[model samples]
Target: MSTQIVILAAGMGSRLGRSLPKSLTELSDGRTIMQQQFDNIHQAFGKDAKVTIVVGYKLEYIIDAFPEASFVYNEQYDQTNTSKSLMRALRASSSGGVLWMNGDVVFDPVALERAAKVVARDQSFVSVNTAKVSDEEVKYTTDAEGYIRELSKTVKGGLGEAVGINYVSSRDKAALVRQLARVDDQDYFERGIELAIEQNGLLVEPIDISDLYAVEVDFAEDLERANLLFS
Candidate 1:
């Protein structure tokens, strides 16, 4: 099955206190987060893999930075969240499987390959990090069999952080679309996944990536940490 990579990059990233979009934030290596992500995807998937980036805040900057990537603009990005941006990408995608990611994260290429491998085998998967999880991170709990049972920021005593990468097989795409359509605009993309799992019995296995480096650049401190970890 062909895989499509959908990046949700439409948020303003107000917490980062940066004028530029979070995806455009420069790493210590001189490459922007978007550039590094593109390189990592190419490393894992190949140079010609299909990638679609959803843009809203500073759309022109993202467009100029990744001229070859197909973009879906979310004009109401300020009023919505990742769920809405992800819905747009899902609607635009025609591939049998999709690898979705939050644009603000930078991770090891090996982690990306591991996620891809899991998706290839299981058809649907969520990348989870067993590393130290802060209170602010998007946490999740898995079932006895290791599938995601619940996912949210407030899920206390959870297994680990989601690490902002998930794979959706075409088998589950329609259910996910319906669930996303029913969610509030402010809901996170994982909310839709949670609904699909609860209502439709969609199986999303969790792939542990404790050995890999992956950080979401939310605040300035996170950016510094990401630079140090990924550089």
Candidate 2:
């Protein structure tokens, strides 16, 4: 079954203060963040990789910017959160699995290359960084079997921060789609993942990428930090 790489770019990105989608934010490497992401996908998976973008805020701009990719519109982009947007992507997917990431995250392409192993095995996983766990970022804890247990911004004694990149195997996609739909409108997609784990015993592995550089470009400081990687 073919795999689809989903870019969740529907948010208004008001915090980043960008008039366009956050993924369109340019990097010092002379590529927009999404372009870098596309390049990384192309490099890692070759030309045959199926790419999809979930667009909402300033959807036209994103569509115009990347006319080659498939798109899904999140009609509730202004009111809903990542959970809803992700649900839309999963619902629209024709592939056996999806490898997805935050549109705003500036990451080393090596992370995706490493993650391809899990995609090959058709396993579900969430990319994580154990180097630092911040209060406002999504954090996670694993079960005794090393599968993800709790996942959210408010998780206590979290092992590390979830890096906003993830995968869902074909076998697990239905459960996630159900939970994402059941989650609160304001809840992040992590909440849906947690619910799926609790309600359906979904076993999601945590792939450690602490050695990598993947920054979600949220605040001005984060953008600076990500840009510094190119400098």
Best by lDDT: 2
lDDT of each: 0.89, 0.92
Best by TM-score: 2
Q: What overall lDDT, based on C-alpha atoms, would model 2 receive against the true structure?
A: 0.92
**Which runs of model 2 end up more than 4 angstroms from their true locations?**
none
- Per-residue lDDT tens digits for candidate 2, residues 1-231, read 556999999999999887888899988878999998999898888888899999999999989989999999999999999999999999999859899999998888899998998999989999999999999999999999999999999999999999999999999999999999999998999998999999998889999999989999998889899999755
* lDDT per residue (tens digit) for residues 69-99 in model 1: 9999999999998898999899889958789
Candidate 2, residue 18: lDDT: 74
TM-score quality measure for candidate 1 = 0.97
CA RMSD, predictions in order: 1.1, 0.9
